[model samples]
Target: MELFEHLSLGFGVAFTPINLLYCLVGCILGTLIGVLPGIGPVATIAMLLPATYALPPVSALIMLAGIYYGAQYGGSTTAILVNLPGESSSVVTCIDGYQMARKGRAGPALAAAGLGSFFAGCVGTLILAAFAPPLTELAFKFGPAEYFALMTLGLIGAVVLASGSLLKAIAMIVMGLLLGLVGTDVNSGVARFSFDIPELTDGIGFVVIAMGVFGYGEIISNLAQPEHEREVFTAGVSGLFPTKQDFKDMTPAVLRGTFLGSALGILPGGGALLAAFAAYALEKKMKMKPGEVRFGQGNIRGVAAPESANNAGSQTSFIPLLTLGIPPNAVMALMVGAMTIHNIQPGPQVMTSNPELFWGLIASMWIGNAMLVILNLPLIGIWIKLLTVPYRYLFPAIVLFCAIGVYSTNNNTWDVWMVGLFGIIGYSFVKLGCEPAPLLLGFILGPMMEENLRRALLLSRGDWSVFVTRPLSAGLLAAAVLMIIIVMLPAVKNKREEAFVEE
Candidate 1:
C-alpha cells in the first residue's frame, strides 16, 4: 500500500506536461551527445549546468538524469557503428559491438544494447526505490568516524578496481586528492594552494576539471589519430531484431549484469565505467559454449552484458548521492553541485523534506528509460547518418562549444585557459596509458574524507583509535584493508591488469 502510494505520487509529479517536455528534450540532446565522438555525459552535464538555472529543481534533475541514461543508450550506437565510444562506459561495447557491425549484425547489437539497457534500468530504479529507505535508515547512524571510514572504503575500492597498473591508479588517486585541496580551508580560513589567485579562493570548479580532462582532452586525442582511423565503419545494417539464439545468450547475461551493476553502483566510486568493464570481464571468464563466438570477436553476450551493466550502474550510482550526500563519480559530483544551486542539500533529509523531488526523480527514470527505447529504435537510421559527419568538421564545433560553455560558468577566460592546460595533462595520461576516471573520483571524494577525518578526531579528543573502536567504522576499515590485501595479491593484480586492457 505504501509503495503504491509513493509510486502514485511520483507518477503525478513526473507526468506533468512541462516536466515531460524537458525530459523529451533531454533525451534527444543526450542521444545527440552520445552519437558524437569525443563527448561524454560528464562533460555534457557540466556544460549544460548553467541552462538548468531557469528550470524547477525537480524538472532540472529529471532532465539531467534523462541525459545521463540516454547517453548510455546512445553510446552503444556510436560504439557499434564507428568503433568510437562516446562515453567511457561504452569502451567495452566496442570490443564486440563494432565487430558485429562489420558483419552486418549491427542491428542486433544496437537492439540488444537498447533492450538490455531498458531492462537493467527498470530493475536498477526498482532497487533504488526499494533499498534507499533502509540505506537512509542505516545512514542516520553514521557519525564522523563512520563517514571517514566509508570514504576510505570508497577510495580503496576505486584503487583496487581501477583499470591499468595498480601503482599508477594509486598515484592518480593521490594526485586527485591534492588537486581537491587547492581552495579555501573550511576549517581555518587559510587558502591551501591558491598561490594568491583570486578565483582560486572559491576552489576550482568541478566542471572545469571535467571539461578539461574529458572534453578538451578527448578533442586533442582525436586530432592526434590518423584521418583514416576516424572514418565510420560504413557497414550495412539490416534485420532490426535479434534472433532466437541472441535471446538465449543475452537474457542470462543481461540479468547477471544488472545484478552485478546494481551491487557495484551502491559502492562508493563504483559507476557505469567500472560496471561495464567488470561485467565484460565476468562474461569472458564464464565458460563459453562449444561453438559460439568468443569475447572480443562479436559475441552478443558481450554487447548485452556491458550495455545492461552500464545502465544499471548509472542508475544505482545515484544511491549514495541521494541517500548519503556522497557522489560516487564525476557525474554525481556534478549532481551535488546542481542540488546545491537549488538550495537543496543532498542528504537523507531530501526524502522527508522534498518527497516530491525524491520520488519524482525516481519515477522520471522509468519514464526516461521507456522514452529512450521508443526514441532509439525508430531513429536508428538518423543516428547512423550522424556518423557520416567527418571528424575534422566535428572537432572544431566541439572545441568551440566547450569554450563557450566554460566561459559562461564565470564570464571569464581563465577557466577556458585552464581547460587547455588540463587538456595537455589529459593527453599526457592518454599517451602514458593511464586511466583518468579514478582520479576524478578521488578529486570529488577527497575533501569530504578530510572533513570527516578532522571532525572524527575532534570528537575523539585527537585520539586516532575512534575509527577502530566504533563497531561500524571498524568494520568498514576492516573491509577496506581486506580489499587492499586482495588487490595486492600477485595473481589478482595480474588478472585485473589484463582484464582492463582494451582489445
Candidate 2:
C-alpha cells in the first residue's frame, strides 16, 4: 500500500511535460548511438552531462537513466545485424544474434532479445521495489571496516570474473587504483601524484576518463580494422515476432536471467557484465539437445538469455547506488556525480529526505522501459537500415560527436586531447584481447575502496583483522576466493578453451 502511494506520487512527477520530453529525447538518442558500433551510452551520456546542468534533478536523472537502458536495447540491434556489439554487455548477444541474422532469422532473434529484455527489466524493477528497502536497511549497518571488506570482495570478484589472463586483470586494477589516487589526499590535505598540474588537483574528471577510455578508445580500435574486414548487414529482414518455439525457449531463459542478473547486479563491480557472462554459462550448462540451435551460432536462447541478464543487471545496479551510496560500475559512479551536482547525498536517507527524486526515478524506469519497447519494435526496419551506411562515413560522424561531447564537459581542450590518447589505449586493449569493462569497474571503485580502507584502518588502529572480524564481510571474501579458485581450476580452463575454439 505504501509502495502504491509512493509510486503514484512518482508518476505525477515523471509525467510532467518537461520530464516526458527529456525521456523521449534520451531514448531516441540512446537508440541511435546504440545502433552505431563502438559508440556507447557512456560516451553519449558523458557528452550530455553538461547539458543537464539546467534541468531539474528528476528530469535530468530520468533522461540519463533512460539513455542507459535504452542503449542496452539498442546495443542488441547491432549485435544481431552486424556482428558488432555496441557495448560490452552485448558481446554475448553477438555470438548467436549475428549468426541468426546470417541465417535470415534476424527478426526473430531481435524479437527475442527485445522481448526478453523487456520481461527481465520489468522483473528486475519489481525486485528492486521489493528488495531495495531491506538492502537499504542492511547498508545502514555497514561500518568503515565492513565497507572496506566489501569493496575488497568486489575488486577480487571483478578480477576473477574478467576475461583473459588473471595477471592482466590485476595489473589493470592496480593501474586504475593508482590513477584514482592521483588527486589530493583527503585525510592529510597533501597533494599526491598530480604532477603539479592545476587540473590534477581536482583529480582527473570522470567525464574525461570515461570519454577517453570508452568512447574514443573504441573508435580508434574500430578504425584500425581494415576497411574490407568491416562487415555490413544487407539482408532483408521480414518477421518482427518470435515463433512459438522461440517464446517457449526464451521464457525460461528470461526468468533464469532475471534471477541471476538481479542477484549479481548488487555485487560491487562489473555486476551487469558478469551477469550476462554468467547467464550464458548457465544456459550452456543446462545442455539443450544437440539439434537445438548451437550456443554460439545465433541461437535465440543465446540472444534472449544475455539480453535479459544485462538489462536485469543494469536495473538492479541501482540497488547499490541508491541504497548504499556505492556505485557498482562507472556509469553508476557517474550517476553519483549527477546526484552530487544536484546537492543530493546518496544514501539510505535519500528515500526519506528526497522521496520525489527517489521514488520518481524508480517510477520513471518503468515508464522508460515501456517507452523503449514501443520505440524499438516498429523501428526495427530503421535500425536495420542503419547497417547499410558505409563504415567510413558513419565512423567519422561518430568521432565528431565524441570530440564535441568530451569538449563540452568541462570546456577544456586538454580533456579532449586525453580522450584521443585514451582512444589509442582503448584500441590497444581491443587488439590485446583485454576486457575494458572490468578496467572501468576497477577505476570507478578504486577511490571508494581506498577511502573506506583508510577509514577502517584509522578506526581499527591499523589492525588488518577488521575485515575478517565482520561476519558478512568475511563471507563475501570467502566467496570471492572460492570463485577465483573455481575459475582457475584445470577443468574450468579446459572447458573455457573448448568454448573459445568453438567460437
Poorest lDDT segment (10 consecutive residues) of candidate 1: 228-237
Choose the strongest candidate by TM-score.
1
> Model 1: runs farther than 4 Å from truth?
285-291
Please report, as a residue range, the 10-residue window in candidate 2 with the lowest summed lDDT.
494-503
Report, for every candidate in turn, its global Cα lDDT versus the true structure.
Answer: 0.87, 0.81
Off by over 4 Å in 2: 285-292, 461-465, 470-502
**CA shift at 150, candidate 2, in angstroms?**
1.4
Error of 1 at 279 (Å): 2.7
Query: Which of the numbered candidates is closest to the native, going by highest lDDT?
Result: 1
- How close is every model to the real structure, measured as TM-score? 0.96, 0.92
**Residue pairs whose backbone atoms clash in candidate 1:** none
User: How many backbone clashes does every candidate have?
Assistant: 0, 2
